[model samples]
Target: MREIQYEEFEEKIIEIRRTSKVTKGGKNLSFRVVAIVGNKNGKVGLGIGKAREVPEAIRKAIADAKKNVIEVPIINGTIPHEVIGRQDASKVLLRPAAPGTGIIAGGTVRAVVELAGIQNILTKALGSTNPLNLAMATINGLKELLDPRKVAKLRDITVEEVYKGVRREGNA
Candidate 1:
């Protein structure tokens, strides 16, 4: 058996609908479901499944999401830098914020970011707010994050010193 690492909760189905197509003999019906899965611990996944039954489709979507889990790096409870991502029609702009800023986001992007363990950040959703697209865009933004420590090492400077300079400049 495969072990499940994420504690799944808040399972939601969006755009649940049924459609029918007329064939030569009869009409064939199909169902579509969009599923969102998350651990509420800085890890989130999304999957879409289509089937004849709603329950089976949801189960399949959850399984697929689990298999496709992606790890998002967190720094000081926020992202390291600004990032722009697109998923279909959804375009998201994510920016890291200083401590105590809290999360500034809306719609599905908010849920994904919160679950991804981001505490202080800013986000803007452009183009569309379709749940799946927004979620995917948030994931894309998370994937582009780079830890401040890593950036500090790359620039050969201490993280604290970098912030100290910013503080000094802000107070001036």
Candidate 2:
């Protein structure tokens, strides 16, 4: 993992909803913000924050996001493999694309992927279309990515063997 300063991360506000609560004191209004943060170098995070003001809510969200950062394995500006991530009813399918393909995705998915330093990718959002859910699903899918070296080590094989799809004589 690369050690980066907090200021190096890029932040995007996915959604902001004004919520109200009915109580003895008439109604209480608050703003809820969904935030995505990334360093564009394989690290990203998602967060939600609520407050009476938008700026404060955004600040809180950014802070929360920084705390939940996850590392993504990016290869040649794309993901290592395909994956599907789920959050509630939202499902995000992430596929690696050839170089120069750019990012083909919806607004929410694009923000997350671009911030994660992915220049080429394809994404499909399934089920719920809610911005918060979609963002979470994208992050979840990225979190599921596996590095080739790690996979090879776990399987007791060389990295080249993992890519070549060659099986040992004794192994299935």
Candidate 3:
């Protein structure tokens, strides 16, 4: 059996709802959990799970999140560029911000960014604010991030040249 690491115990439970289904005998109650998982280092995941008990539901959600973790590229403490992501009816707009901007995101996006160890970012929720959808959208946005190093390699330029251009522009 695969052992569960102690670190996996850490997770943010975004939302929990008790859902019931009517049956011939009466009603069956179930719990739904939405969770965000991250290593606080530009890797994050979101998961949703349903179970008869709240703890079990959360556990399942966390496991799913770990299995789905995505690596988000970070540059100068922020994303390399702006990105838009959508999941179902939820849309999220993510923009890279200068350092010290301090994560100007709301709700689920904020939690995701913080856990992903992003120090500066701007985000807007364009559609449904449902926690689950928002979380998933944020993850999708992060998945699309491209690092400056990768961009520099693609453009056949040194990373230092990229920063030098910005510095020159600031001084001018």
What C-alpha lDDT do the candidate models reach, one value each? 0.75, 0.94, 0.85
Task: Write down the TM-score of every candidate.
Answer: 0.75, 0.94, 0.85
Better of 1 and 3 by TM-score: 3
The stretch of ten residues in a row with the least summed lDDT in candidate 1 is 163-172
Q: For model 2, what is the error of residue 168's alpha carbon versus the real structure, in angstroms, after optimal superposition?
A: 1.7
lDDT of 3 by residue, 1-172 (tens): 8764535424788999999999999999999998888887877778888999999999999888887777888877888889998899999999989888898988789989988889999999998999888988888888887777887788667788765654444455
Q: Quick one: best TM-score, which candidate?
A: 2
For model 2, the local distance difference test gives 0.94
Error of 2 at 4 (Å): 9.5
Prediction 1 global C-alpha lDDT: 0.75
Off by over 4 Å in 2: 1-7
TM-score of 3: 0.85
Rank ordering of all candidates by lDDT, starting from the highest: 2, 3, 1
- For model 2 the TM-score comes to 0.94
